[model samples]
Structures are given as C-alpha cells and as structure tokens.
Target: MSYFRSVALGAAMSLAGVAGAAAQEVQERTMTLGHVVAEQFPYHTSAMFMKEKMAEETDGKWTLEVHPSGAMGGERDALDALLLGTMDFTWVHTAAMASFVPSFELFNMPFVFHSPEHIEEALSTLDFSKFYEEADAAGFKLIGIGSPAFRYPMNNIRPIETAADFEDIKMRTMGVSAHIDTYEALGSQVASTSFAELYGALQTGTVDGNENALSALNAMRFNEVQEYLTLLPTVANIAVLVMSKSTYDAMSAEEQALVDEIGKQTVEKNNSDYASMDAEALEAMKQEGLKVNEIDDLSSFVEATAPVREKYSQDLEPWVRDLMAEIQELPSAK
Candidate 1:
C-alpha cells in the first residue's frame, strides 16, 4: 500500500508539470507589419528578417504577419490603419511620415548627409532617440531607421548636366512639401503622384522626369520608360519602421524588448544591403542604353537651392538645424 501511494504521487507531480508547460506554450502574440515596397525589395527583406528574429527570440511566442507590395495599402493608408489598430506596424518613408509629424520633414532636405556612413552615424546619435520618443507620444513607436538607396535623376528629356537643365521640366516628386519647394527653386514644375502610377505617368508624358534611388528605378524598371540617367546624388532617402503604440503596449515586457532588439538588427542589415544594391542598380541602368551623365558643376546645383534650405529652416522645427550641424561635423565617409 505504501509503494502504491508513492507511485500515485509521482504520477500526479508529472501531470502537474506537463500542464504548466502547456500553459506557458499557449501564450502567443501576433502582429501585422505592412510595407509599400515589393517583397523582393531590400526594405521588405529586412522586415522579414526582423520577423524571423522576433519569432526565434521569443521561442515562437511572438509572430509577425508581413503584408508587402502595398498589400495593406500605401504608406499613408498603412499609417491610418496603424492608428485604427488594423495594422500593427509599417515601414514608412520620411516624406510619408511628414503628414503625421511635421518635424520629420527635415529628413527630406536636400544633401542632409554627405555620404551613407555619415547618414548612418548621424542617425545613430543620441538625438535620434528623441525623435523616437516624440513618435511614441504621438501614438506610434519609432523602431529604427531603414536606409533607402541614394537619390538620382531619371528623365525623358535631356540629361541633367547643369543647373540650367532643370528649367521648366515637369518632374514627378513624392507628395512632400520640401521636394515641391526644392524643385520649384530649381525652376521645375513638381507633380505629386503615387508610386503605382509613376510608370504610366512617365510613359504617357504626364511628367518628363522623376528622381529616385537607383534601386527603386531598377525595381520599377523605369529605365525602360525614361531615356536619360544622371548620377546626381541629391538626397539620402531614409525610411522609418514604426509600430502602433497600442500594439506595442499590449505586449509583455520581455516581448517588447525582443521587438526593439530585432528592429535595431534589421536596420543595420538594411543599411548594408542597400549600399551594395545601389551600386548594382546603377550599373544595370548604364547597361540598359540609358545615357548616364555626370555633372561637372555640382556646386551650382547646391547653391541654387540655398533659399529653399533657408525656407525649410524657418518652417521646420529648430531640431533640424541641430541635426544638420551634427551631421556636418561627422568624419567623412571612406
């Protein structure tokens, strides 16, 4: 009778342990991440990497369902969805974020960073954290910066060889104020349009020119529609990945930490991947029979936009000047 009682007690203890483990395993969370870029795009790839890492870190307790290629909607739409709690996260362009957070327009300022390394360093500074905090206050959690490829010009008109070349051309620009102001200063008519309509807009003569990173041009096959390519590095288009505060706040402390760490890792991977892809895309553009032109007088282009920058300073937050000054002081990129 004593031996039988001891056996029954051992069985009960084993069953209790199994029940506890099952309870822990049932604690799972799901999040939806949206991106405007295609699945093959670097930004989307980085998001996927983050999703995988998040799952691994939490031992499958956390999972992200990615909606790529504008499946959820455009940047603005995705942001609205996030606010409504329909979308948990998204990778939005700085220009897109400008509508929600006016202070973010500072990033669209031309020639903000001299090089990719400088851009990365400036962004990694402590001041950048303040922007994230501000985002949190505004109902979203700014995860980290995703580096889009370098900006260049593609035109159906002539190659942009000089400042005079920009005179009176109709250029399609992202629907952002700074871009409109900058192009207006350059003597071009800026038309705001969505990415989905850009190719048709270019082909149908709705616009004579457009500017974007080489990777984007290649991804969209704009070389087939545009006749000229100019290696004019105008801006470093940065993307910010954000999560809805409602979604983030609902997670446990351990899960939140995992998400934050994954965001940092994804940002670094995106930066590295973009640098390489930008070079490859530029080469591909050259081989596609597009006339590539290198401007001899870049200073003229910069000087022509002085008034625009001054106006941006007046209109934007004081933090813009502070961030710009910090970027200028950083060591040159190798």
Candidate 2:
C-alpha cells in the first residue's frame, strides 16, 4: 500500500512538470506587426499603444515587434505575408482588404458614415462583431478600425465648390471599385493609383485631383502641389488592423483575450489622437496659402449621387445595411 501511494505521488509530479513546460512554451512565442504608414502617422502611434497594452496584459509572456514606415512591405504584400504566417499582424487600408474579403468594399462607399462618432459606434456594435467573426473565418482576424479622420478633396485644377466643378476632372483613387463609382457619379474621370505614385501623377497631370484625409495631405506634402482644399466631408476612410488567423490561433485563450482587449483600447486612442492631428494639419494648410473652400451646399453633391447609391445597393450585403442602421441609431458626438 505504501508503494502504491508513492507511485501516485510520482504521477502527480510528472503532470505538474508537463504543465509548467507548456506554460514556458507559451511565453517563448513572439508576434510581429507590420504597417505601411510612416512612424509619424497616427496609425503607427496606435500600433505602439496596442503593443504596450498587449505586453502589459500578457505580463511579458508575449511581445509585439512593430515594423513601421512600410519596412515590412506594401499593403498587399504584408497581407500576403500575414496569411502565410510570416507576418503576424498589420494595419491595412480597407480598400486593400477588399482584395481578400470583398465585403470590405462596402467601407469605401462614400457618405456611408456621417461622422467619426458614427463610424466608431458602428464598429463597436454587434453587427461589426459578426463581421469580424466572418473575417476570422476567411483566414484573417479584425483587431480594430484605425481612425482615418474626415476625407476632403484636394486638386490642382480648380476649387471644387459644387458637384459641377467635378465635371471633366480626372481624379486619382485607391483603385477600389466603390471609390471609382463614387467619383464617376460626381462627373469626374477616376484614375486608380497607388499612394506612392500619387505625387508623380499629380505633377505629370496624370490625375488632376485626389481625395484624402487632411493629415495625409499634409504628411505627403500634397499641399505643395495642390492648390485647392475642398472641405466636402466626402467619406471617412478606415484603416483596419488585422492578424493572421493561424498566428492568432496559436496563442493560448488568455493571450487571445489580451490581444482583443488591447485592440479595443487602441481604437479609442487612435480616434482621439487623429482628431487632434487633423485640426493641426488644417491650420497648417491655411497658413501655407492653400485656398481652403468650405462648400455650403453639400446637398448638391449628395443629391447628384442618390442614383449612385441606389445602383450600388444591390452589391452591398444585407449585413452592411444592418450595420448602417445600427450606426444611425447611436448617439451622435458631433
């Protein structure tokens, strides 16, 4: 009986050792997050914030290595790397995500979100949670949406005061179908171009105008080449942070929870920081002698695109409409 008791004690000791080894193994794993934005960009700041949050939550068991300023690769290349598990995470523009999950194209729909608060509320709602679940099934997991502030029109041709000013103007776009459709609906010829190529396109007259957030215009020095800033509030472009499903699944349940929590915190921080940055950029642009035109009649722009929205409604899945409705119901911060 004493021998039997000794054997039982040995078995328990072995089980405890095995558990300790497994815990140690978990602590050894590292995650690398990549992005195309410069270190000065708000997206990078948010990425850093996420890293700190995740590190604290995991108690140093997991560490995040951030690659900023397009050090890893371009948006498409980074996404491909994530799928292959060579890269663990990244913040990609929604237009870039459309290549993997076509439903993301709906995010490019102009005027879908009226304000930053609306967009944030929609993202935190149940509908977007379901959308993230679907995205996880597609081999990528949504972390959170990066704040893109308000988009405005900048052009070299002429000041855009009305929708009619868009007539015959060739505008550069992110090469997404929805954006192309929106610009075309406004009577402008849309030319799809990469952000890296935009300066040359503008200088060589390949495209006469481009739409982007105020921060991007200032960061990219578009103000140097562009003459007019049309505050049309056309869209709220989003940068979506995502992780490879395989990489995420490799994490223990506790580690997964930490990452999820960090993502939520990062979103709020990004939104608040981006809003302040945008205001500063706007002031700087005004000081630089850029003609800043605020369109009092945005109704003309919205009215002219009514048919465009109708034509594209069929292309949008029912989930998008559900998400939009939820967003509309949220309390406005504007």
Cα RMSDs, all models: 13.6, 13.7
* Candidate 1 lDDT over residue span 1-334, tens digit each: 2222232234221111111123243358788998988777777887888788767665687788998988988999988888888988898888888778767876787766555556757766537766787787777888887784457778898878877888988888765677777777788888776777999999998988888877888888999999998776566688888888888888666556666777777777676656656766767877888788765456777777777777777777677677766776777432
How does each model score on TM-score?
0.84, 0.82
| Cα displacement (Å) at residue 112, model 2 | 0.8
- The TM-score that candidate 2 achieves is 0.82
> Where is model 1 poorest over a 10-residue stretch in terms of lDDT?
11-20
lDDT (CA) for every model shown? 0.74, 0.74
Tell me how candidate 1 scores on lDDT: 0.74
Estimate the TM-score for candidate 1.
0.84
Determine the C-alpha RMSD for candidate 1 after optimal superposition of all C-alphas. 13.6
lDDT of 2 by residue, 35-117 (tens): 98778777788888877765655557668899998899999998899889999888888888877886776677777666565
